[model samples]
Target: MTQPDFSQRLHGIIPPVVTPLKPDFTVDESALRRVIRHLLDSGVHGLFLLGSTSEVVFMDAPARREVLRIAVDEVAGRVPLLAGVIDPTTDRVIAHARDALAAGVDGLVVTAPFYTRTSQAEIAEHFRAIRVAVDLPIMAYDIPVCVNVKLERSTLKQLRREGLIEGLKDSSGDDTNFRLLARECAEDPDFRLFTGSELMVDTAFLVGAHGCVPGLGNVDPAAYVALYDAAMREDWTEARRLQERLIRVFNIVFQGTPRTSAGASGVGGFKTALKLLGIIEHHHMHRPNLPLNDEETVRVAEILRAEGLLPAQERKLVPGV
Candidate 1:
C-alpha cells in the first residue's frame, strides 16, 4: 500500500465528518451515509471520518471499526476518506491505523498521546511506528489542546527528512507556529501542512498551508468551498468577506465553554445546524453530554438564522420541538 500522492491533491477543505448515532447511541448507518453524500454534494474536497468531531475519544473499538467499514464502503472512492486514529497509546493506535488502512482509507489522521506529557522523542517514535506499520500517507494531527503533544517545526521536518510522515494538521490555532512550520518544511514540496482553525483560513493560505479541516465546514460546506476557491484565485476581498461570516458563527459556538469542551459544542452545533437545514434525521449527540439545552439550541438557531446559514423554513424542523 504505497502512500497516495497527496503532494498534488491534498490542498482543499476536508471536514472531520461527524458520526451520527441513533437514539440508543448505536451508529446510525443510514444517517451517516446521508451526511457524507450531502457533504460531497455540497463541495468539501474530501471526507475525514472518526476524527475528533466524531467523538473518537468516547467511541469503543468495535464502533470505530464499523465506522471505517461504512465510510469506506459507501464513499467507494468518490472522494478521499481519511480515518481518524486518535488513541493515547502508540501500540494500540498503531493497531487502529492498520485496521483503518485495511478498510481502504486513503490516509491516516493521527494525533500524539494525551492526558500525560510525552517527550518529543516519544511523539516522533509514535508516528514513526505507524509509518512503518502502514504504507499510507500520514497526516500528523498536531492538536496540543487534545493530544497534549504538539508537533513542532524540528520534529515535523525530521520526520519529513526520514520519509516517515507526509503532512501535518496544525490545530494549535497559532499563526506563528504554522508560519515556522511552513518555513521549515518549505523546501520539501511533498510535506503538506493544513490549518485546523476556521478563523485563520486566509492566514494559513498566506503562510503556505496546504488546506484546512475546519469544524464549521460541516455546516457551511458551500461557503467554505467558495472561500477556498477565492483564496486559490487570489481574490482576497471575497475570501475575507466570507471568512468574517464564518468567524461570527465560530465565536458564538465557542463562547461560555471551557476550551477542552468547546469542540464538543461545535460538533453539537454542526449537528444542530444540519437538522435546521433539513439535511439529517435529528440533532443527536452521544451521551454523557446531552444535546444542547433548549435555550442554547434556540440561541444557536437564532445565530445561524441571522447569518442566513439557516433559513426560516428549515429552522422549524429542529429537535425538541
Candidate 2:
C-alpha cells in the first residue's frame, strides 16, 4: 500500500467512544448509534473506536470489525476516525489494521505488545513492523498502567523521527515525561500529541498537547470540546473552570471501585452515566467484568447532578435505583 499523505494534523477533541451493550452482552446497535451520534452531534473533532475505554481488549477480531463497520457507516466521514488496532502481537495488530483499512479508518492507535514482556528495542521493532505493513497514520498509545511496560520517551521519539507513528496518546500519568516529549517534538507541527488524562487536559494544553482522548468524553463530549476551544482562545480561567467541572464529573468512575475491577469501574461508570443521561439503554459491560450496581448507579447520578449534567426535567432514573 502506498502511504497516504498524513499532512493534515489531527488535532482537537477526539473522543475514545464507549461500546454500549445489551443485557445479553451483545452490541446494542441502536444504543451504539445513538452514542456515536451523540459524540458527533456535540461537535467532537473525531471518534476513536476500540480504545481501552471502548473495551477493546475484551473483544475478538470479528466483533471489533463489526463495531468499526457500524462506526464507518454512522460517521460517513464527517470527521476523521482513528481505529484502535490494539492486540497482543505485531501480526495480530497488523491483521486488525488491514480490517481497519478496509473499513476506511483515517488512522490507527497502537500500543506496546501486552501479555508478553519485551524490551524497549523489541517494542520499537513492533511498531516498525506494523508501520511496514500498514500505510495508515499511527498513534502510539503510552498506557503503562494496563500494558505494564512504558513506551519510554526515547522509543517514542525514535518512532516519531523514523515516521513509524504520526501521534501519541499519553496515558502513562507521567506529566514531566510527557512535557519533555511535547517540548522535544515542538518543531513538528504534524505530530499530534494527545493526553488521555481527563483531569489534566488544561495543564496538558499548557504543555502544548494537540488534543485529548478522555474516557469521560463518552459521557460529556461538549465540555471537552468547550475546554479545547477555551484553550485555543488562550482563556486559562474558563479552561480551568471547565476542566474542574469535568474533574468532578470524573468522580463517577470511582463509584464502583474495589468491588469492581479498575477497567470495569471506569468503563462501567461511563456506561452507567450514559444510561442515566438517556443516551444509551443499558450500562451492561463486557463479560467477566461486573456492571455497576444500583447503589453505585445512584452515586453516579449524584455526581452528574452535581456537575449540572442532570437536569430536573430530563431526569431518567434506572428502575429501582
Candidate 3:
C-alpha cells in the first residue's frame, strides 16, 4: 500500500477508537468493523487504535494484536492507521511497535515510560531507542496524566530538530506548553501537531495545531470533522459554535452516574454511548474495568437523545422502565 502523505492527510479529526469487546472480554471483530465503518462514513480523517480510548492498558497481547490487525484490514489504506505502543518501558513498547508495524499500521503513537518516575533525558532516550528500532513514522503521545512524565518543550524541540519524531499528540492539558510547542514547530510543514483535548480543539487550531485526536470523536465524529473544517476555513464563529455543541456531547464523558466511578467513566461512557447508538454490539469494559450498568446506559441514551443523536422513539424506551 502507498504511504499517506502525513503532511496533508494526517491533519483533521482522528478518533481514538474504542475497542469493542464481547462479554467474554475478547475483541468483537464484527462490531469493531462496524464502528470503523461508522467513523469512516462519518468522514473521519484517520483511525487510531489501542490508545487510551481503546483500553490498551487493559488488553492482553493477543487482544492488542487482533485489534491492530482488524483495524488495518478494515481500514484498507483508506486512511492512516495509528496504533498505540504505550507500555511502561522501551523494550515492551518496542515489542508493541513491531507488532503494530507488522500489522500494517501507518505510524505508531508512543507515550513516556510509565510505572516509574522518569527524567526528561530518559524520555528523550526512550523515543530515540524506538526510532532506532522501528522505521515507521512516530508520533509522540504526551498524555502526562496517564504517562506521568510530560514531554518537555525543550526535549520535543530537540527531537524535532533531530528528525526523531514526525508528529505530536498533546493530551497534557497544559495550553502554555502546547502553544510553545506549536510556535516552535510552526515552520516545519511535516511536523504535525494534534490535540487530544476535546474541549480545546478550537483553541488548538487558533494556535497552529494541525488537528485533533479527540476521544469524543468516537461518539460523534461528524461534529469534530465539521469543527476541523470550520477552523481550516478560518471561520472562528462557526468553529466555536460547533465546539460548544461538541462540548455538550463531551459531557457524557463524565455523566456522574453511580454505576461508573470517575476514573472509569470516560471510557465507560464512550462505550455505552456507542452501544446506545447501535454502532457497536456491546459496551463491555476490559478486565478490571467495570462497564456502565443499566441506569448509566439509560443516562447515556438520554444524552444522545438530547444531542439529537438518538431518534425520539428509541429515547422513549428509558432504562428501568
By lDDT, who's the top model here?
Answer: 2
The per-candidate count of clashes, in order, stands at 0, 0, 0
Worst 10 residues of 2 by lDDT: 1-10
Candidate structures ordered by lDDT, highest first: 2, 3, 1
In model 3, what is the error at residue 189, expressed in angstroms? 2.5
TM-score winner among the candidates?
2
TM-score for each candidate, following the candidate numbering: 0.94, 0.96, 0.95
Error of 2 at 235 (Å): 0.5
lDDT, candidates in the order shown = 0.80, 0.90, 0.87
Candidate order by TM-score, decreasing, is 2, 3, 1
| TM-score of predicted structure 1 | 0.94
RMSD of each: 2.1, 1.7, 1.9
lDDT against true structure, model 2: 0.90
lDDT of 1 by residue, 13-80 (tens): 99988788888888888888888888888888888888888888889889999998988888888777
Candidate 2: segments with Cα more than 4 A from true spot: 1-9, 313-316
User: What does candidate 2's lDDT look like per residue over 106-196, in tens digits?
Assistant: 8999999989999999999999999889878899999988889999988988998898988899999999999999999889877889999
User: How does model 3 fare in lDDT?
Assistant: 0.87
